[model samples]
Target: MKIAASLIATLALAATTIAAPDNKHGNKPNKPIVINKKVLQTSKVPFIPHSGTALFTNWVGLNVDFKYVKPVFDLVNATKAYGNGTLISRGEAHITTIPPTEYDNILHPAGVTIEELNALAAKNNRLQRARFGLECLGRVQVVTKDGVFQQSVQIILKNYKDILSYRNDVFKLFVKKGGNPALFAADNFTPHITIGFKNRDIFIEDGVYKGKNACIHPIVAK
Candidate 1:
């Protein structure tokens, strides 16, 4: 009877050890990775307070083309059958900084109409295009809970600091035009090019494709 009790205790200890959470990747076992699927819902403009629901596009961002990095797209597309295909256009990768809700609050107070906002975005694009561009480093694979995965290309701005300066300068312009500078979040920005999103964590072959190109267009209300 003593031997039997010892075996039970040993088994319980082993089971508890096995059930302990693993922190190999620094992610907590129960914490979820929330992938932004906002782009998928393009038809309806997401709701914003104190703004008229005029069917206006919710966000404006910098559109970087993949002309120099077409091979990366080819690889992602070839492996897309496993789960997800490319959602972004072959022509441009959207760089979201000023999200719509905040943008509305920034502009509406200043009486900046949609047409005027577009014009400002276009002007900012032109000013930046004359100075710097973006570079593609390679592929970055992200594996989430339940084995869901996503592939994206790492993008680096050639003059990131300079571009940031430009963003600040443009924010000043908007503020002068009646928008709020306090609404901008400069700390939470990251630069990357998303290739595709997957439903399941299926292993897709990862590879590197290298190139650099000038980013000319900044699409607003698009």
Candidate 2:
């Protein structure tokens, strides 16, 4: 009787083991669940040439189409009562790829003339083919040519991978021509289009006037 009972107990134990839920193949503890996010499509803004003087003759930049940025200017102009500031003319809009100081200190010393640099940039077919996209509008305080702090409204650029890559290639070209790698160190380049400058006291947040002088309408890219 005892032997028979022991055999039955062992069989029951085996059945329980077989019936148990197998977690070895299940999700591991503390593992993060990844969600695939959808990429938003950006609207295309067309470019139209406008006649105006360059803000900095010594600075080199990629010219932006004025028609692409006219809406922002119009919005700011409509809300000029919020604060007094000068709007950047259509011709002044550009993405500054290289600053004036860098041209004088780095490229010139390395025997990389502006003409040669332009020729190299022109050869970059990717830049010519890529279309520009609007990212967002933001307000920042910038120093004017006269060395005074002025609040400026700027259009931050997006889909600018081609521009950034071109700048890196330009640096590499200079370095290949015997430029110092240490002097040509990477900079925190924020490619933006300055629309206008306003009084320091005026509060413009993310391209909109805020607080007492708030704008009635929000700035739209269209």
Name the candidate that leads on lDDT.
2
Report lDDT (Cα) of residue 22, candidate 1.
32
TM-scores of the models, in the order given: 0.44, 0.57
Please give, for residues 88-146, the per-residue lDDT of candidate 2 as tens digits. 44434566666666677777789867666566555533334444455555454433333
**Predicted structure with the largest TM-score when compared to the true one:** 2
- Give the runs in model 1 whose Cα sits over 4 Å from its true position: 1-58, 76-91, 124-154, 177-180, 186-188, 199-222
Per-residue lDDT tens digits for candidate 1, residues 66-101, read 443344444434433211345333454444434455
Clashes of each: 2, 0
Native-to-model Cα distance after best TM-score fit, residue 103 in candidate 1, in Å = 1.6
Worst 10 residues of 2 by lDDT: 33-42
lDDT of each candidate versus the true structure: 0.41, 0.50
lDDT of 2 at 152: 53
